[model samples]
Target chain A: MDLLLQLTINGLSMGSIYLLLGISWGLIFAVTRTFHFAHGATFVVAAYSAYFFQQLGFSLILAAVGSVLAAVLFGMAVEGILYRYLRKAFASHLVVFVAAIGTLITVENLIAMGFGTDVKTLEGFPIKVIKIGKVGFNNLHVVMFATAGILFFLLMLYLHRTKTGKALRAVISNPEMAEVIGIDTRKYFLLAFALGSLLVAPAAFLVTIERGATIDLGHWAILYAFMPVIIGGIGSLPGAALAGLIIGLAESIGIWKISSQWQVGIAFVVLVAVMILKPTGLFGFRVYRGKI
Target chain B: MILEVKNLVGGYQNKRVLHGLSFSMGDGEVVGTIGHNGAGKTTLLKSLFGLLPPWEGQILFRSHDITGRKPDSNVKEGIAYMPQGQGLFPDLTVMENLEISCFGLDRKTLKKRSQQVFELFPILEERKRQRAGTLSGGEQRMMSVGLTLMHEPTLMFLDEPSLGLAPRIVQLVMENIIEINRRFKNSILLVEQNFEQVKRVAGKIIVIKLGQIVFSGILDPALDKRELWKYF
Candidate 1:
């Protein structure tokens, strides 16, 4: 029972990371209707940017801030430059998706060539284990959960309270009507990209500190990101967060009965089960006709 | 003239819908545009409002040449377009729909405008917390018009305001359109398939067939529905 409790705590902490990734990707997809597969590249860029900044003698806090800034710029540039150009060129959804895939491949390859394929860890974090009864967790786990909770609260507040945030919601709900109402859908699309990128930075930073950064992490990050979104429903942010937690918990618990090597497979099994049973996702109201 | 479209030509890619269409409207006028399904009634509003770029010709709005300007710019310049169907965000609450329509307005103005909307459609206020998608068809139509009211637009392009509603709801919507024109002094270009409803509210009637204006004149109360059938 104690072991189960420990695993649950670990799962929740990991789930928090997945929740951040899922909502980050979900926000961009819901708002822009863009299959932004290159979001994986943005994750790698953020992690590498933090590591690069720290190597240049910046404090850990400054490095994280710098990483977020880099992620925002890179994400916006992907939308403003690549996606915009493809849209102007009259690319179909499939074509744009292919372009995004190509971008992800190119970026991952470039990073691999630049930083080498080997793992590189971020230095100077004094991680300590904390115990609650028989269950134990690191301080980093607490930080991860706190960060995700705070950010999610702030995001919900922004979406509900601010003019720009409402505009983004308007675009997500109905792009054509949003345009008619003068909400500037293009500007909101860029904003979605920026915010989406910003959301992923902490996940990238946390993961780099926990398990070190690697070029291969991009594809894994994106896979986890997409699984939660698809499992939760295409356009529901809260759904994605919940699905992320479910997947994290499922994977963690499954390891007790099977080899830990099958951890990733456990998430896939849950995804398949949800797809077969629900199809629209756990929280999806209907087949996505542009509702956030 | 508040709006003048001179030889406007535009349509979807590789297909022409509005072929050299020309018309003009005075301030605070309610002009009803009647036509068949493919008669380019919606296209005319779309082109003038900048949803679709004009292939040729000019659109002068309040004497300013706004030809080919996007919808956002046209909206900023006091044009409001309520497209066919609900023309609202279904997932958003009725209040949210109203809030987003006049996005950048200050709190005072927003409250004032929202009150004005409530005055126009009091049912909207009662259902403010309800999601717009779940509203009855008539209520959804009312909320659509209410959204346009939030910005206090000088000109409104309302496509098919009475579409797909019961006879009683249709009458109510037509009456609301009349009230909107009367109270707000907004010049309206109303598109409708049902000429009976248009005749009740419109001062002038513009008939289009296959994208060309067949008739543009006063809505004579004595005009026969049979006579209008020939144009269609």
Candidate 2:
């Protein structure tokens, strides 16, 4: 029971990380037709950015904000320079996909060169310890879970209630019509990329704060979130989030029953199974012969 | 003149669709422009809205040059366009579509503007939360026009709005167009196929054949010769 409880706490931490990732990936996919396959690079970069800022004796909050701002600006610039030209060209989107892979390689190499390939952890930040019953847990997990909840709530409110959010959805649904209706598609895309990059900042911090930062972690991290986007549903935010938690639960329980080696394989099995069952997944929008 | 297009020539890619087309509309005037399939009526409207890059022509809206701007930029200049097929985002709710057009307006202003728009199409107000894609063709047209009215444009450009609508709905839309011009004092440029429908609202007619304006005058004169029906 204690082991189950501890694993549950661990699952929460992992789930929160994937939740942020799913939201970021979902946002980019929703507003822009192309997926930022290098989205995880922003996460790793934010972790490194947060680390350097902390090394400069900046407060954690300041480091977090700085990382988010830097990532947003970089993401917007990347979309403008690369993704903007790929609009309406699915063939060219393949080129952008290769370019995304290139971005991942470039960022990882830059980080490895600057910060070295060693695992760098943010230390001495006053860790908060909490114990409930016989199970002990870190307060950061609570913070992680809480932050994910808050982020999702705020995102839902913005997407559903605010004017800008409505415009973003309109642009996503029918870009040409949105323009005639006065919603600038370009402006909405910029906002989408910025928000996506911003979501990754905390996920990066969570990863680094828990395990440590390394260049290749982004590629691995992206695969985990990508599963939810695929097996769960594409362009659906809630489906991704729910699937993130499900993945976390499966991995956590699977480790208890089987070897840790097969933990990654569990996602793939679920991916293949869910895909074969209902190709569109939990909350997929029905497409009419690829029209919708 | 509310709108002036001169020597406009453009289309998708290198294929030129419009060849030196020119026309104008005055305030509160409804102008009908007709042509056969591929006659460049839609292209002319798109060029005026800056959707396509014109090979060469200046578009003046309210005496201001707006040739190279984007669709949103044109909306800011008080020229709202409703594309053919009543181009509404089918997945979104009527309220959602309305809000998209009310982008520049603030909350309070948007509230008032929405109410005004709702009055223009009361059916849309009743189905405010319904998805646009599910509405009937006539209702969708109303919603599209309702969405356009949210922009508060002084000039409305409607492209083939009567394409698939029933005769009754077509009349409703035409009446709404006349009412819109009467209520808002907006100049309307209507690209339509239904000749009688166009005749009901349009004060002037311009016939485009293979991208050139073959006639520009009152509708009665253009339709005086029964052979002119081929141009439509």
Candidate 3:
């Protein structure tokens, strides 16, 4: 029973991290339809940026703000320089997909070159443990859970209550008509990329604080980020977050019950099963149907 | 004049659909362009609204050059366009559909503007919270037109407003358009395949065939000439 409780707490903490990653991926994918595989690179780059900035004697909060802003600028640069031209050239979705994959490879190599191939760690934060019954959670887990909760709440409010967010949805719903209705499709595309990067920044910071920063983690980051989106439904942000938690829990509990060697395979199994059973995902509605 | 196009030539890719098509309209005028399918009516409207860049010639709005400008810029200049078929964000609610148009407006002004749209179409007000996709065809058409009205554009371009609608709903849309023209004092360039309906609302009429204007005159003069029916 104590082992089960410990595992459950661990799963919830892991779930918060996955939720952040999945929501970020979901935002960019929902609005831009870019399938931005380089999102993982953005995550790790942010982590490294925060680390290096903190090493330069900046405070942790200031370092986080600066690094997140840098990440956002980088994401926008990718959109402005690469994706925008690809779209203007009327490139096929397949071509864009290949280009994004190429970008992911290039960014990962750049990070590895700049930050070194070794894992870099942040200075230890004041560690405080909170225990409930037989389960225990560290301060890092509490912060991760709190940040994820606050961000998700704010995101939902933005989507439902704000005009610009609604315009973003409008673009997602119908691009051509959105333009006709006078929404700047290009501007919103940039916003979508920026928002996705913004969501990733804190999670990147959290990872560095908890474990450490590694360049190659992007490979696993993409899977953790994308699986929730695929399982939750492609265009649904809340669904992605929920699916992230589910995948996190499954991976943690499943690994405990089975062998730890099969940890990575849990996400793959859930993804395949969801695709076969309910392709639209748990909360996805048909978007951009038929002709204009 | 509200808008003038001189020898405009453009089309998708290398296919030049509109060849030297020229026309002009004065302020507060409701002009209609009538033609058969594949006659370039939709293409002409798309060009005028800056969705398609003109290969040649110039477009002047309020005596300023606007050739090849983007659709959003045209909207800022008080021009709104509604494309053919169901050109709406079906996933949005009626209120969201209306609110998106008034994006440039401030919060208080947006609230006031929404109330005005609700007054224009009471049914929209009643279904403000419902998803636009679930609405009936006529209701969707109303929401589409209402979306244009939210910005209160001075020049409106409507492409096939009556397409795929019941006759009764068509009549309702036409009536609402006339009301919109009267209340807003907006200059309208309406494109439609329905010659009879165009004849009812259009003070002036232009006819296009194979991307060129074959006729441009008052509706009565063109209607009196039975041979002109062939162009329509």
Candidate 4:
């Protein structure tokens, strides 16, 4: 029916944003094994940075590029300054987890201090709607889909075809063995964090442009991002994207059939179902470390 | 001397495995370290290659102290380590495994080295696209040895190359090691439990027992296997 078509279009558009968030989280998690809860903070930082630059008389595209670059630098800084020292000190997983949570709180507070605690809006995004048979498409949605599609293609190419990308995969596969093979796993870790942060940049800007910015946006970003990754495999980028789309579709349909209040809960319902059925997500495999 | 480990002491947290172990190897020398399961042979190799840094004494490579350098730095300095259990990225393909071994090399060199690997082990060529995890046990061993050669290291540490392979495959692996040593002129430190394999490939033999070198000398065919068994 017409309703189904409309829901599907909305789902796909939402899927594009969720896919970026999932991939960004998955990248850093897969490489560094840091459950990077602070990604939520970085998401806010990037959006706010974009908003700041745009307000500074820069073009939207230039602002977006600058924001993404800033996010990457922030990601690297987090790893180098916080996580690296903890790892060197042989900190336990719980300690590292607590540290990550601490980082999230610190960054979130900083954002509120710099940008106001109140929700802020981003203007100037031209909203031109196009009508299909029974569904409508906005220019922003189309742009979101196109950007997601193009970036996904490029990411796949980078992961499978490039040397540094393969090095990242190697580190993810067996970090200790990767070291024995002369791979500087640290460099690959930085690359993963940077790439992951970079992937989220456009999504941050687009979301701000579409829905406006809020202090709570980063917190919601983590939830939206992590659910897809958990539903997919933790380290599988393709699965994360696929799961993102599935969650988005489910949310759209659920909102239409049920109530709008349950829209966010739909993704979690799917996540719980997936956790019970397939614990490793869709594409997770055991990473082989050498036996002693 | 290419490598000299002087009174080196190292182990896991609180459990010292190498208790003042000392040994030295010259260029192009294939030193065989043979020991029982708990004799710390693997630990010794791990310490030398920087997997576990020595707690005491010095590790001199080309007269420079590389006592506790990181494993990646050691590899870059011409030392390659292939640990037991065929330390490989099992999910990656044979080509991927070879490529990752010499990461950061130019595409042309990567391709050329891959070709050379195929030539060294033609079976690897046939399974270039196959996931390394799914390969047969013998094939996995071959791929492990082949990977270390990708970087063209001047010094190599092979931990238990013949640990879990058929007699036929063991022969093939030993042959490959001998050929690699001759061709690359690499100083090799081979740790293995199989005394027969050790005697076959190593000109100098060192026996480790309870984290210490009990014996060090040239391979003597006249020496009874029972005599070495007693030490282990």
- Chain B TM-score, model 4, reads 0.97
Could you tell which candidate, 3 or 4, scores higher by TM-score? Answer: 4
Q: Across residues A1-292, which tens digit of lDDT does each residue of candidate 1 receive?
A: 9989888888889999999999999999999888899999999999999999999999999999999999999999999999999877778999999989888899989988888989988988889998889888999999999998888888888988888887888888888999989887888999999999999999999999999999878889899998999999988888998898888899888888999999999999999999999998988877555455
The CAPRI-style docking tier of model 4 reads medium
Per-residue lDDT tens digits for candidate 4, residues A139-230, read 99999888888888898788789887778888877787898998888888888888988998889999999888887787899898788888
Scored by CA lDDT, what does every candidate get?
0.91, 0.81, 0.86, 0.86
Off by over 4 Å in 3: A287-292, B221-229
Candidate 2 per-residue C-alpha lDDT over B95-144 given as tens digits, one digit per residue, 9 for 90 to 100: 87776678878878788888998888888889988988889888999888
Count clashing pairs, candidate 1.
0
Encode model 2's per-residue lDDT on A1-292: one tens digit a residue: 8999888787777878788888788778777776687886777788888889889998888888878887788788878877786664434767888888888889899889899999988765567889888888787888889888899889888988887887777766777787787677887888999998988788888777778888898898678667777755777778888888777777877789889899889878877888888888767755211111
Pull out the clashing pairs in model 1. none
Summing lDDT over every window of 10 consecutive residues in candidate 2 chain A, give the lowest-scoring window.
Answer: A283-292
Native contacts present in candidate 1, fraction: 0.76
Residue-by-residue lDDT tens digits, candidate 1, B1-232: 9999999999987899998999999999999999889999999999999998899999999889999998888877889999999699998899999889988888889899999999989999999999899999999999999887778899999999888999999999999999889898989999998888888999999999999999999999888789988886
TM-score of model 3 (first chain only): 0.95
Better of 2 and 4 by DockQ: 4
In model 4, what is the error at residue B185, expressed in angstroms?
Answer: 3.3
Give lDDT tens digits, candidate 3, residues A210-277. Answer: 88888877777888888998888888888889998888788888977789899889878988998899
Model 3, retained fraction of real contacts? Answer: 0.81
